[model samples]
Target chain A: MNLEDYKGIWIFVEYTEDKISELTFELLGIGRRLADKLKVELSSVILGHNIKCDLNLLFHYGSDKIYKLDNKHLEVYRTIPFTDALEYLVNKYRPEVLILPATSIGKDLAPRLACRLETGLSADCTELDIGPDGNLIQKKPSYSENDYITILTPNHRPQMITIRSKIFTPQTPDPNRTGKIIEEHLELNESENWTKILEIIEEDQEDANIQEAEIIVSVGRGIKKPENLGLIKKLSSCINASIGASRSIVDLGWISHYHQVGLTGKTVKPKIYIACGISGAVHHIIGMKSSDFIIAINKDPEAPIFQVADIGIIGDLFEIIPILIDKLTIK
Target chain B: MKIIVCIKQVPETNNIDFNPSDLTINRSHVNGIINPFDLNAIEEAVRIKEKFDDVTISVISMGPPSFEKTLKEALTYGLDSAYLISDKLFAGSDTFSTAYILAESIKAIGDFDLILCGKHAIDGETGQVGSEIAENLKIPQATNVKKIEFHENKKIIKVESDTENGYRVLEVKLPALITVNKEINVPRIPSFKDARKALKIPIIKWDLGKLKNIDKTKIGLTGSPTKVVNIEKFQKKKDTKFISGTPNEIVNELYQILKDKHVV
Candidate 1:
């Protein structure tokens, strides 16, 4: 656990369909800050078969160094081979801190990597900082869900923290900035690996990535009946925005779990997020608090949602939605 | 196939009370229930058992002896067996230490094909223990699973991982570990027949000496790298600004406030 043994900050650069995940860039922004604070270099570990586009983008996002392990076996993400590759890098060059996006791949891969390294990892962290004593402090909401608990990895060689996407804004890429590239060879036998990616069933592209949507129209328990959701859908279509909901709505089977936005749900950072009849429980707030604009429409002005909302409306959503829809149609 | 589901007894959030003086939670007044996320994992495990008649499902938990009550509740779901790992020596364990003890206990129990866990515990919310356990056992693992399919002949397991944007379908060998999200499945309530059977069954409890290759340093607070240096009761701000207007007027006024806040 010697501090000098670990050299720099590293971000796991994840990609899909030969495209860089937005979370990769977001991690770079956060990694840059942590690296600057700790006075260490910021690096990225890119694993893919052919990631020419992704490699170029990593330099743009401020990676001081890139560790590329390009191979046919690394084409799709699986547990064993991917973990083996990452474990190799972490062992070879110990990092002072590692930041990963709390996405499905990141969540699955981060914990496995931490365990292999026999180190400490903090997951779904909303805030990360360096303590005066030079320890990595990861802060997240605790039991009550109202307050945050700041955690520090005191004895671990490389403190790992996974940040949920959309919690931090991505910084602008500087084309002028450049860094060195370090290539790592994959040594594991593909046949011996435990997991294999069978097939990639591509979902419809028309479906919006709720976490990345600029405008979102979210429904809650106040919708009353499932049929009334058409109004929300109509509004969403009119505005060309995606539809989201609180956990209550999802739990009630009013919508699929994919539409859920909250603590246990997807954390959306939409430019404009409208809450229709949502009471805004703390569990729900953790997901959408990062949204750039929040408009809460609830019958109860006392609802917790109003506290964090930029606009708080006190009236029935049924009455207001129609009028707003009519106004928008005319405009 | 023998599936081992690791569950925890957590304080129901609704019943939790805050201690202002020390900023600690008062657990005495709160009722404990199986962690909600673990319930989903247990349900999935039961579904797998039903698919394979020879499958044996065991529910395991590590906590105070009274936490064995949760094992009885698990029996109501038709679990084949239950085990409780309780010892005062394992108190105040963080994820690192907790995983070590659980892994050791799992090895002692033997005959395990798959291990299931909730993606994260509500009490700790760290989501590290399941991975830690898999690491300790040297098994492949996956988290945030939305769907699971088993290939009995090939001994391969396919899991759909719920990513932030979409899903990643992964096929892994058996004798693996998985942590499921609540979205995976709906848990069923126990029937009267199963409930009666559960009441008759006794949980097998174990102490530190019962586990093999026990690492004392990695079983408690000593093995933990992170500590809760401080915990303060959270207090919400008491400021409330009330505005009076007709529906249309209020909408207009709210719109103005939203504009000022750049929320529109």
Candidate 2:
């Protein structure tokens, strides 16, 4: 475990619907900054089956080089195969820091990879930087959104961290930029995988995911009855917004957990977030506070949600929402 | 069927304040509750035990001795036995060290058919311990699991893991680990009789010495590679513009604001 053996920063490149994931692009933005600070190269590692994309986008996004491994076993997102391939790469070409998105695929792969490498992996990091002593400084929100703790893997090589998407803005891609592509070969035995994928069910597009929604109309216990969701629907329809919910309503079975916006649910950052009848608990606030513009309608003037809202209206949502919908519908 | 469920007791509320001087959570007035997701894991394990024959469920946790109270409460959910690994030396362990302690304890317990854990603890929210344990034990793992079904031979498990867009069904071999998500099932409330019975059940306590061949450096803070350098209060802009008046007036003002922002 010689720290000197690790020299560069690497970001795990992920794909969604054949294109590089937005999160992976975002990682390159931060990875570029960190690599520049350490005076080391920033590389993107892609492991997939028959990846057809030129992967010039990695360089355009900010990668100095690309390490790719293409094999039939690496096609689908399986924990064992992905972990084995990554373990091979990290050992063959040691990286000082490895970053990944805290998305479903990344969360599943990073921890297992960390265990195999016996290194430290910080989870859902909100901030990453180079410390004074040249260690990767990982900052993440603790139990409470109000408190953030900075962590450092002082004794580990190839420090690892998983960051949630939308924390950093992706840089504009420069098509002129190109990087050295290093295609790596790994012999993976299919028999090593103890788990087999049976099927992948893509959700029907009946509703946009709140995380991807441009505008969100989120509700809470203040909405009262289940039937009152009609009011929220009316408002959302008028504004072309996706419906989001606080954990309380989601837990009460008023809405699907997919629409939940909070600590246990989804972290959403939309263009405009309208919180109706929500008290704005720290849990709920952490999810939507990052939205570009936040408007809160709550009867309680002291509701914590108001603390983050740009525009706060202390009124009954039942009365306020209908009129607001009418005004928007009229437009 | 032998099932091991890993659970954690966390602060009841996420509104914990930070002690800037020592960079620590101000836990002076906070009470602990079973991590909410772990309750789902406990309920799922209990449901499986009821659905099958010869299914013995054992719960494990690592924390302060105060966690024993939580383990006892888990038994009220119809789990068969409980184990708590607590030691002063294990304090301040990060996820890696914490996983090592739990994995070592699981190894000492010998053979088991399945391991279940909450997707992540609410307090730390690392979501790593479950997967790390599987790696340490060199077993297959399915995380963010929403549903699970057993094969007729009872040697393989098919699980639906939540993905970003939808779900993926995976078939994992026996002796695998699965971390349950809150969407899996609703936890059932125990009756007074169950509580009384749970009180009568004895809990097996383990210290650092209880884990055989355990590396002392990897079991606690000293073994931990990561260190908390600082704790700071999150700052956000508090310049909220309050709109007052009748419902109509407020809506008109809000609509005007929205129109100004070109949102309408």
Candidate 3:
């Protein structure tokens, strides 16, 4: 229980197809800052059936050391083997803090590790800082995304947190930076994993979700019918923007689940978000409220969406959208 | 086969607002609803009971005594029984501590075949409890279970769970846990007839005294590794500049603003 035993900040360097994920680099950016604030070393952990991943990129990002478990058993992201290997590494080289990207792997593994270590872990933290006593100060939106709650793992050694993607920008790669790479022998065998990845079936989904779109034209119940979506599409095509919808529209089967934008849906941080006819429930607002420029057009002046919009036009979206389309086309 | 479904009661999200004075959630201002996702888990349990022979569904929740309201609501879905693990000491427990108490409850129940939970609570959205509970019980766990099928006298359960990368069809042994989302099945509304009958079934309430060998340090807010340090409203430019006039004038105004921002 002595905090002195855990002395370094560690980032779980996740990989996809032999390349490091952006979240790993983002954590490195924040992780390095935390390490500096705590006056401790920064390290990265990678456990994969890897033969081809490069380690230099990790150091270039921010890692002072890399603790890796490279073995055939570690190739797949089965819960048991990874936990066994990670638990061993964490116990051997105890960390003051452990940060992981809130990807599926991290979501599955972080809790198991924390449970084994009997430590506290914050999930989907958007903001993190070193507190006055060297504890982790983590902030995340509460269940409804209505308010942000700050969390601290004050008493636990190796305080854990899983941060959401895009919360932090990554540090630039410094090719000159060098770090130690410590490899561990995988003690876990295949027999330890009770569950198996029967088969991975990746569907070819070409649609651009609101999360990655630069410009999103999102709609809500104000659209009279599914056909009225054409009016919004007209504006999107004119301005080269993607289509997004509120949960009500998606639940009506007017659009697929992938295009829904809300707390129950995808979180989007687009450059320009156009809310047409959307009443702006707290759920829908939280998803796209982070957009750079928001323009809300609705007949109801008091619609909540207008509260977050930079420019609020109180009018019928059916009327406003067509006129805007004409203007954009003419320009 | 005995199935245990984990459910949680959370604030109705639609009306959630924060206190400006202290950025923390003003829960008193918001009404409570059984987490929408947990309803799906309860439905899956009911559906499994209907399909299989000699199957009983038991629902469990950890919260204040009032949480029993949600448990009664679940019983209306035709579940066999319910248990409320409510205790003042359990307050402020994080996902880990919460999972530990549930795991202990499962062990105490003994002779259970399966545990099911919603993928995540909408309020917390952590999605960490099922896996952590499985780890504590040393049972296999699967998340995002889209479709699940039991085979060979319920020795193994086949599941198709969605991951960020793709869907993986996994087969895990019995005495395992699976967390499901909306993709699994449509939750049914409780029938009035069943609701009446459900009200008659006395709910077994377990407090800290009921759970034996419970470590005091690992049960409540004290045992929880995570602590809430602060709460703040996530910032957004809330005030807006309304563009008034005719539809034509509004469009013209929007175009000029877009032009100034170079959004065009």
lDDT per residue for candidate 2 within B94-156, as digits (tens), equals 888888899999999889999999999987788999999999999999999999999999999
* lDDT (Cα, tens digit) per residue for candidate 2, span A1-331: 8789899999999996578888899999999999999999999999988897669899999999999998888888999989999999999999999998999989999999998898999998888889888999999887553678899999898899998887887888999999899999988887634589999999874685787788999999999999999999988988889999998898899988889897887888998999998887667777788899999989987677887889999889988898888888877
Q: Tell me how much of the true interface, by contacts, candidate 1 captures.
A: 0.38
* Per-residue alpha-carbon lDDT of candidate 1 for residues B1-264, written as tens digits (9 for 90 to 100): 889999999878644444433334556767889999999999999899888878889999999999988899998998888999999888878777888889999999997889999998876676788888888888878788879988867378888877654677888777888999987899998889989988888899999778747878766666776665654434343233444467666656655564565444
Worst 10 residues of 1 chain B by lDDT: B233-242
How many angstroms is residue B81 displaced in model 3 relative to the true structure, after the best TM-score fit? 0.8
State in Å the error of residue B216, model 1: 1.6
Pick the winner on TM-score between candidates 1 and 2: 2
Stretches of candidate 3 exceeding 4 Å from the true structure:
A191-193, B14-29, B235-237
Clashing residue pairs for model 1: none
Ranked by DockQ, top first: 3, 2, 1
Candidate 3 lDDT by residue in tens digits, A30-90: 9999999998999999988754678899999999999988878777777778888888888
- Per-residue lDDT tens digits for candidate 3, residues B1-264, read 899999999888655554444334456767777888888888999888888889999999989999888888889998888999988999989898999998988787777888999989887788888988998898888887888998876888889988664688888888888989888889998888888889898898998798986777897878888888676667544667889998888888888987887768
Candidate 2 CA-lDDT value: 0.88
Pick by TM-score: 2 or 3, better one: 2
